[model samples]
Target: MRRLVARDERWPLREAFVIARGAKRQAHVVVVEITDGVHHAHGEAVPYARYGEDVPGVLAQIDALRPAIEAGADREALLRLAPPGAARNAIDCALWDLEAKQAGVRAWDLVGRPPPSPVKTCYTLSRAAPAAMAKAATANARRPMLKLKIAGADDLAAVEAVRAAAPRTRLIVDANESLSFEDLQRLAPELVRLDVQMLEQPLPVGEDAVLQGYESPIPLGADESLHTRADLEACAARYTCVNVKLDKAGGLTEALALAQDVRARGLDLMVGCMVGTSLAMAPAMMLTPGARFVDLDGPLLLARDREPGLSILGSMIEPPPAGLWG
Candidate 1:
């Protein structure tokens, strides 16, 4: 016999996490658990408002599937059952965790992906004033890579401030789709000069089509615009890389497929995350192999994370402990 459960959780952030979109003081997550009397496993997902997902809706989606999942529905069946989003992510990952625990093997082993090793992740500097961002960057100068959240036309000012404060640290800039195509073109040369390694979603999803065939100095990656494989072909023409957040891909099952599709398009991979505990990052960690960038520092931003969390020191992230999830 099988049992399934889903519930909502809220974790306070150590400080407000500010991005181009806005600010979040807490990470709202939906957790799913599955068991067969003894062997048990769990998965966690952050419901993102940008993707039109909310806690109640995600929980309802998971709740609706309990009967099917308990009746022996598998991961493959889950892809067809739920559209790509947080709800499916929770259930699919929980299924993987349950299967791995039942089989006495790691989730990576089951997926045919290589065993996970320690990965270098990017520390995010929240959207802030130029002086404040520089101060924050200086405080975190030990980090190897810093992902700056940029918002306005004055992004170059903020980037310059951060770069000057943390000269040795590599940088990735995420505009969160706030820049217009003209502004992006105007800023590309300056970003390269600043030695920024990448730019994430500089323009809004609807406005991103303008980036197609526009040569850029720094690599441009798709985030909100690139979800399932359905967005692959179009994204290929617009950006050089794609950010795969498990919440957007649904779960590990489809994330693997999406990464495969990304490679087919000759785009670089970046495994990112929505703010949550280590339970969320554990599964996302499985996708970091050979990825150009890993942005799994969500747990680092929280005031407190669950026990057995991923060990993160600055930008260096150790793989998730077995007891966490996968």
Candidate 2:
């Protein structure tokens, strides 16, 4: 029989992580470990309140499913039994880890994908006063790309501030579904002027249908607006790209299929992450080959991380270290 262990951890961020919705100083995540005989594997997920997930609730769900999961439940079975959320993410990831351990291969290698190498990624400039945001961008000028988070009417100033601060860095904007139609229409030209490469989820989740008849200079990506294959038709009509998060998509089992489907539809893809340890980012890094952007900097915000972590050089994510699961 396999033993299942789950726990909650609150890692303090080196600095406050801001977005249009609010600011955060701590990243709360839930971790699950499954062990049988001498083999052990682990998985992690951020308890995103925005998605109606709380640490206690997710842990409870995992505890209830421990017996079934340890009894050799497959990823699909885990998804069906737990619903799609942090609990399922942890369980799904744990299964992948176990498989990797038994096969004596990294998860990426087992999936027929090359291990992660250094890849340029977008570093987030969270919402703040224009001046403060500019300072943050300036400090991170060496980063190849910057993903600026904006909210409300001050967005224009935010973009301008970052552009001025890091003139050479490629810029992307993520409104986190805070902008209105008027905001998009008014900001598209300025975004172009600032050389913003893409815009992510400017409108609310279910309301992205507004982009059906809209036109903008910068490519628009779906994050909160798109999750599973079920969201494809509407997302296809509205977005030029889709951001895939393992937690949101269930796990690599589903994310891989979703990526293939989205690519077939000709949409640009981005692999993103919630705030967690390198354990979370390591799995996500495996999905980067076809991605136009990779936002696996969740561990970068943490004041500490799990031992034997993936390295982040500026905005580039290095390959996972040996013994780092996935």
Candidate 3:
């Protein structure tokens, strides 16, 4: 029988993490580990309040699944038993880790894929006032690219401010489903003039149908707009790119499958993250090869991260450490 272990961690953020939903003080993550007699593996996921998950609830669910997991539950079967949330994400990742360890190969390799190379990633400048956002962008001007998070009407000011602050750096604006059609229309010209590379999830998930046949100054990416493969067909006509997060997709099994399907459908890939530790970001690196942009800077937002973190060189993400998962 396999053994399962799990725990919750509260990693304090270096600064308040603000978004359309709200602000976050800590990145509350739950990590799961699975071990057979000879090998062991681990996975991490954030318990998001927006998703109706809490630490206690996730732990209880994992406890209930222990017997089934030890009795030989494959990832597909595990999904059937647990709904898509942090609990399942943790367990799914741990199983992938265990399999990779047992096979003496990286998870991606054992899963039948090549390793991802170093990729240029976007360093995020969280939502702030126009002046502060400009200052933050100026401070990070050395980064090859930057992703600016905007919340509401001040978005134009925020984007313009960041643009002026980092004139040469490539820019991507993520409204996090906060903007309206009116806002996008008004800002398109400015975004184009500013040379913004992409606009990510300008509207809420269900409201994205409004973007159908819409002409955007830049390609629009799906963040909350797309989750699983089931969402792909519906989003095809509405979006040019898909942002994949291991947590939202329920870890590597589904994330890899989704990435493959995304490429097959001629959609650009963007590997992103919730505020998390390197353990979470490490597994996500496997999905970065075909990514148009990577935002695995979760570790950078944390006051402190778990040991042996990924190297963030300016805006480039380096390879994961050996034994940090695939």
Report clash pairs, candidate 3: none
Worst 10 residues of 1 by lDDT: 313-322
Best by lDDT: 1
- What is the Cα-based lDDT of residue 210 in candidate 2? 75
Q: What would you estimate as the lDDT of candidate 2?
A: 0.85
TM-score of each: 0.98, 0.97, 0.95
Q: Which candidate has the highest TM-score of all?
A: 1
Give the least accurate 10-residue stretch of model 3, judged by summed lDDT: 317-326
CA lDDT, candidate 3, residue 81:
89
lDDT of 2 by residue, 1-326 (tens): 78899998888998899887889999888988888878888888887888887889999989999889878887878767877778888888888888888888888877787776788777888899889999999999888888998886467897899999999999989999898888888888889888999989999986767799787788999999777788888999998999999888877777888889989999999999988889888777777887888888888889998887888777778887647775
In model 3, the number of clashes is: 0
> What is the per-residue lDDT of model 1 for residues 185-259, given as tens digits with 9 covering 90 to 100?
889899999999999999898888888878888899999999888888899999999999899999998898899
Off by over 4 Å in 1: none
1 versus 2: better TM-score goes to: 1
